[model samples]
Target: MAFSTITNLDAAAAQQHSHELLDRILSTASSTYVTGPVGQGNGERVLVLGGTGYIGRALVPELARRGYRPAVLSRSAEVKNEAEYADAEVIVGDATKAADVAAAVKAAPTAVVISLLSGRKPNDVEDCRQVDHEAVVHGIKAAVANDVQQFIHISDYGVYRPELIPQVYKIQVEGELIGQHHGYVPWTIIRPTAYFPYLSVAFGDVKNGLKYRIYDHGEWNVVNPIAREDLAEFIVNQVLNDDAIGRILPVGGPWNADNTVTLKQAGEFMFELNGKTPDWEVITMASWDKKIARLGRLSKLTKQLKPVVFYLEAAKY
Candidate 1:
């Protein structure tokens, strides 16, 4: 079960599981049974790790528009200057590299560190661990070294214990950080559910035979979505809200899973928006497509994991 109790767990496994569950609980907002509201932000300098991905692209503009300054951490020039952080400072740095991470952190001594990087590739779990898990450890160290008052990490809603949903990656990032890093600065963590923007496209393609999807069946878990502006709003809040420190916050909306509909349904909505007939079909979660071959499932996994399945278990929204 998710977060059964610590007494029943051994150290290492417990550490990993606890870390995961904490992340889930926060992202899913099980405490309030709410997805999460974008934070009430404070205008301040922020170091955004993994600020080149989809969420980052959507989030950076909000950071700038809302009065908070965002600095991006990128190892690739392509990912760095891809119109994502046009308004913010772009720093060439790797989150996992201690020196690079420290240099970036030191550049803005008073800023908060927000981690958005983690294992995203199939063959890159370890790499993700190195950057997401270990590099975060380094960031905390840097935060303390730089005397920053806050460390805000962008975590996921998926990490938690198995069994109740062991198929999921079930483990909390918060636990991993505190247990492993012992951050010296006041810290804040943001855990949000899947994003609606990408899901609209991914699911539409999959159901159209453009791709195969992955799913075991049923909707045991739910999708928690926050708009890019909402995410940015949360970041702004994190920067300004001094009381939010040392807390893990999850943000979502009044409508979560209910708002999360089937691909076909979503497609119809899109078609209506396009002033056309919705011609998409609902692909079986386990359906297979030959064009992308197994890669179809891989692509679907990214979307499914984004809102549905992880480690093969359903999300407990």
Candidate 2:
């Protein structure tokens, strides 16, 4: 069975949705394989696209621990964090391009492919489409060509509720991943809600003499949050387990998100963590624009990045 909770979808929709779930598992005939070589070397081999990012840094090592030979598709020749790079063989290439993906496939045959790349910025929207949307299709195509059996797509907060984004990208990623490609490769589409580790850092900065600001009233229910370590562990566990194939695991951590914790409690946590009290103010839609003005200055953020913090301010997360 696929890992998705979207079981209510009709037949046509179910299979399409299920394809994303299938990519999550390790479906080889044997659950356990010998460490060295079990006659023919059928152990799972994985291709981790975008192995240098935060999630990738955490994931590749876990994948390695599972006995999967995880090779990385690095856009650059050398990875900045060599410790993360140590767990996997690095294949230098641009995942957004077919040629580069083809090279990655050539380097790792019958590999399960996982992409950590996402479109994080406005300028990178085109690139995100190229990487997140198109590259996924092409990567699966390449995997199928190479007889690779599994594909995993990790969609970030930006794909869903990005702080300042226009909000059309969710449909873009979902539509692209769901269209065609059945019978191509077993797949998993993971849409994790807001991330907490990064938030810890962002909020930490705000508490540490770093001025904090919000978008509107930090109103909407704070989104689901999963720790970086937990997410890595889930992906690793799923990738090597066949039962997880054809599943879309929508994972979130417990109490990782809750507005129930009042501002006083949140403030205390942040202040304690950072050793400095934060500058804060509750806002409303009427004052949203004005807040952004003062906020941009207070955050000491750049023109392209003010939205990230402002968005966080609105979050009770």
| Per-model TM-score versus the true fold | 0.65, 0.68
Residue 112 local lDDT, model 2: 81
Whole-model Cα lDDT of every candidate shown, in order: 0.58, 0.58
What digit string (tens of lDDT, one per residue) describes model 1 on residues 234-261? 6666675677876777676434334544
Q: Which stretches of candidate 2 lie over 4 Å from their true place?
A: 1-43, 122-124, 156-171, 196-201, 216-219, 256-268, 281-283, 289-317
Per-residue lDDT tens digits for candidate 2, residues 82-147, read 887675788888778888888888874656888776554433445545765676666767776787
Alpha carbon lDDT of residue 51, candidate 1? 79
